[model samples]
Target: MADPRGLATLPPIRGRVQQAAPLAPFTWFRVGGPAEWLVRPADMDDLLLLLRDLPDQVPLAVIGAASNLIIRDGGVRGVVLRLAGKGFGDIVLEDDGIIAGAAALDAVVAEHAAAAGLAGLEFLSGIPGAVGGAVAMNAGAYGAEVKDVLDWAEVATPRGLLRLTAAEFGFAYRKAVLPTRGVVARARFRARPGQPAAIAVRMAEIRAAREATQPVRARTGGSTFKNPPGEKAWALVDVAGCRGLVRGGAQVSEKHTNFLLNLGSATAADIEGLGEEVRARVLASSGITLEWEIQRIGEVMP
Candidate 1:
């Protein structure tokens, strides 16, 4: 399929937008088709111009590090917005807080904050997504979530840019109350003083734990399902005899039953279908339906 508008003709703004961009390279799964148009804006102003000028009917999808995403086989239509190095990857240290660009890697932010003697964000050291995705999904590890430390955020809505206070985000378990069509530009998190060496030790521990319990090196979309109240999704999955289960090249991670792995040659459908099977099996076995925590998007190929 060809892009009718030919994105290259849009006359060189500060940003570079591409046509028919392969999405696999951008996601953790390493599977999926191309994006109709992929735009990497240079900065907030550039992004704003692209967004405002985009036709109302043209759909928009923003992705961060793509650690928890699975773009389908047929690809994404309209515009797929991704922030580039200069545009949205800065990590700044403020007196009592850290302001991170939405595209900054969670681990990078954690490392920089720890170096600056900022404590309480060590949990982010283990998460492998961008700041925006972390906020959107309330990404967490070791019992701490993004919502817990966030003081406020810089967001861009359809109407205009605004600073959103912590309370305004209406943070909840695994969710943020962002506007339906809004984009997170940056976030501010407050932290306390702590020894940099001590924070590094904590971060190392988190890394080791993740390595031992998860398929961190494998092509996976992190945790597959949210835990049901009073019961862990992994426990139920193991009880249902789903650990090490495989459907084609997709398998339930033997290290962590909550994770689904793409064994080199898996397709998006294979991964998604396996996830669905896991949900069904858990529901049938434990009478509790499992909800996917991973973000599944794009289209299925015929």
Candidate 2:
């Protein structure tokens, strides 16, 4: 069946727009149906215009690296805006800070910061998403988070572009209270000076640690569930005996209990079903209901 939503209804913009764009290729999970509309804005100005001119009735969603997302099989039914790396991937080094574009990979940003002798952002090397996603979720690993170094972030809201401070974001464990319709454009981080060699060594250590503990080479989402307060999620999952548990082609990662893997030919339903099963078992066994760390979007197939 042809899509009922017409592209002609959208405002003209200097970017690529597609109707019924396949979303699976954009995510780590590699499962899901097409997006109703996918818009990749050429630059910040282009993005702003789209946001400002887009009708109030039309919903909009912004995706960064798509590292920590799960688009449902039924697909997303709105404009999915992505910032193209060519225009939104700059990394600028300041005397005491680093400014990174929303599309800049987190690992690349860490590497750039290290080359500039910045110390505090080494933790970003271990995170898989881009800077915007990191800021949106307060992404963290190995004892540090985006909130620790983020001085401010530039966001495009329906009203206009604005610079928001870390405090204003109301950051919490694995989350940030950003505007519902805002799109993170770029971010500034404050870092102290250190020897480049030392920063590189720290990043290397982080990489080695993650490689050893995570299913880095598999088709998987990073972490499935958030750790309950004072409790490690992986340990709880292990205790619940969900390690290596399989449903259809999805399995709890044998290497890491919290990581869910799609062992080839897994549907989005299979993976999501397996996760819910884990949560149910964990809740029954430990009485601590786990919250999801990875963001699941779109609708389920009828």
Candidate 3:
């Protein structure tokens, strides 16, 4: 997928760009195919340059921690961007808020914020995705969501760099609508002073609760379906007689019915197919449709 003409003319930068790289190692499921081209920009400047100069016809997509994504077995075409190292891994504490880069892990941000005697961000400790993904998904747990603390965000739009406040994000439960012109570079979160040790204890409790209820140890995306209003998805799956149900190597987790586990050898198709079957069963029995939490990307083999 490399452009020979552009490759020669484009001045070399400090970033590393690879062609036809396998994406399995970067995703949580440890499955899926390769990316046509992968770019790890040196920093925000490097990212902007690449975005500006790249051909408009070439496809592009960005991934954060990839905790809730499926890239399919056939792989993704064109350029796939992943920020890493110094460029997108910073966490800074200010007198008023915290500034976290796009690639910074949620747990890392949560821990640092707690250590700084900050409240309101403890809920992030249990989320496993990156900060950008959390914002994009409006990720929440334990009665708290990211929107509650988001002060502003820095995004690299097609027009240029822009700052968006909480109101500009138009956040809803588990969803945030960006400008559609570019990607989020970082976010600033507001917090209030709290006891550091007490906050740490609360975070520990959240972590323990997550480990107890979720298939965190299994090879699976966090939750297969979003909860429908007042009811939980797990309860619905269980009542529909799909608990512990197996299709190929994929099983609806007995530990947590909402989570589907890849039992050692499950293919992407197997996992996805089983999820669909569960959704169908739940809909037939309960008369309510379950929406997928995991975002499926790329195409299936023909």
Candidate 4:
């Protein structure tokens, strides 16, 4: 069977669409293949139209900042959407809450909140991804998670758009149960007025702590695996002797054993392979199978 929904046969879209777009530059690791079809939507309405009109067989994936992702070697099979621009990067202070577009960087959201004298979102300053990814994964750091602050999120579904409350998402440790192909458009996070100086201090401390413990300047995906219940992933990686382990041009960050880095010119295959190897070693050494925190997608090169 062939793809029935090629770009030539698609409905009209106001956004820019490319047949194949290089995705390596979109991610932090910078070692993936291209997106078979890349669509940069103009705004939330444009995305909703695309989602509603596209055939169900046409696989849909959205990338926002692309911080903790792995696109496979063979490239994505269908449409890849990158929500950007003022359409999706807008942030506004609304009473006791912050309304952030999906493409709004987590750090930016935190800074905005801090500047507005809102507290409880300082933890977001340490998360490297965007609001959409954070909502998708319930992304957390230090002590708080997205579930703790998310009031509701507007998601573009195949049928139309929906505003789902935080309780609707079955959020867990580093995971969230969402619709099969839901694309988060924007979200409202509950916050309370606090001292601006205190919030700034907290954000600064988190930033410094991250720099001291993690390879913040390196081209690496944040954390490779989620810490198992009552167990740390980095400690297990260290015990398995996977720290600084290398496969092709990919190496586990010695500074932070849980991080996988592309030592320039590495293929996505090498990075994925190294991650599998780490999982094997950790399992063998501790009888605990570490689950990936990073989302891996697309196909292996044939």
Ranking by lDDT: 4, 2, 1, 3
lDDT per residue (tens digit) for residues 98-192 in model 4: 99999999999999999999999999999999999999999999999999999999999878889999999989998887787889999999999
Winner by lDDT between candidate 4 and candidate 3: 4
Q: Pick by TM-score: which candidate is best?
A: 4
In model 1, what lDDT does residue 21 have? Answer: 95
TM-score of the candidate numbered 2? Answer: 0.97
RMSD of each: 2.2, 1.7, 2.3, 1.2
TM-scores, all candidates, are 0.95, 0.97, 0.94, 0.97
lDDT, candidates in the order shown: 0.87, 0.90, 0.85, 0.91
Q: How accurate is candidate 3 locally (lDDT)?
A: 0.85
Q: What is the lDDT of residue 79 in candidate 2?
A: 93
Clashes of each: 0, 0, 0, 0
Candidate 1's displacement at residue 46, Å, is 0.5
Candidate 3 TM-score, C-alpha based: 0.94
Residues 168-187 of candidate 3: C-alpha lDDT, one tens digit per residue:
88998788988754778899
Model 3's number of clashes is: 0
- For residues 173-202, write the lDDT of model 2, one tens digit per residue: 998987758989999999999999889889
